[model samples]
Target: MEDKELKDKLLLSKLKAEDKLKDRILHQINAEQALIPKKRKSKRASKENYFSIFGIMYAVILSLGVYFYSQTEKNPLESNTFVFSVIFVAGSFSIYWFLMVYMNYKKVKQ
Candidate 1:
């Protein structure tokens, strides 16, 4: 019937208009995203860089500990204390780094 045809045409027009509106909104969102500045490094990459730096620091501290231990004959108590302190610092840094890695892993998992 003509009435049914008119209703179908009206429904089709409504759908087309809705599709156009959706496209417009999507374009606007994309345009806004384009205008935003991108970060230089992602979170994972920066974290990796930080961990590498910590690794280097750990190696240096370890070398110093060995050197101090080697020189312990001159002043045993002083050298022991210095070596102990270095060991404590290295342990703390390692624990903290592992905790950070675990936290990142959990975050990624979620």
Candidate 2:
């Protein structure tokens, strides 16, 4: 009976220690979470988005202008307006995608 009582006490102490450890872990998690600031979501990307769009529009217009100007010349086949336009758009989009992925990875790592 004495041995059984000792075993019961040991089990009780073990359970209490586990509960304390769990509480400590939860407290630490909450404390760490409180230290980090959350990012505010913007409802719209107005200014930057608009300017990026305008820049793209301007590029397309400029490319068209170049293409037309080349058409009036005798060496129309030598003009690379279309190729440059394609390269510019592809490069811009790929860069944007890369930046987005990098930003997301950073956010997740944090």
Candidate 3:
């Protein structure tokens, strides 16, 4: 009876180890799936969602402003246009972040 009990405990432990290993393999597979970038889901190639004309204009203006600001006539970042441009970029990024969160929330609900 004692030997049978010991054998039962050993088998149970082996099953437990196998289950844990299986879970780890599944997790690894999921990680690999995530690493494989889904081309259809990527926004970078989407012309409709990618840089609009206004977005390009704003980006160009921001880039030029920042570049000019870095060149010393006076403190470049101190310029009102630079400050406003930075604010605009920050505001746009914040709005985009909120939109992403809201969209994700809606998706989760659905």
Q: lDDT winner among the candidates?
A: 1
Can you write out model 1's per-residue Cα lDDT over 1-110, one digit (the tens) per residue? 69999998888767335668988999999997864433222365547856785887688777776767687645434665776877777777777777776766565555
lDDT, candidate 2, equals 0.62
Query: lDDT (0-100) at residue 102 of candidate 1?
Result: 70
Write the candidate numbers in order of decreasing TM-score.
Answer: 1, 3, 2
**lDDT for every model?**
0.69, 0.62, 0.65
- Model with the higher lDDT, candidate 1 or 3: 1
Which stretches of model 3 miss by more than 4 angstroms? 1-66, 70-72
For residues 1-110, could you state the per-residue lDDT of candidate 3 as single tens digits?
Answer: 69999998888766335668988999999997875565334434343343553476577666767686667566657788767876777677657756765665565445
Clashing pairs in 2: none
TM of each candidate vs. truth: 0.44, 0.33, 0.39
Worst window of 10 by summed lDDT in candidate 3: 39-48
lDDT of 2 by residue, 30-87 (tens): 9888655433222133335545755776676567667666667544334576557656
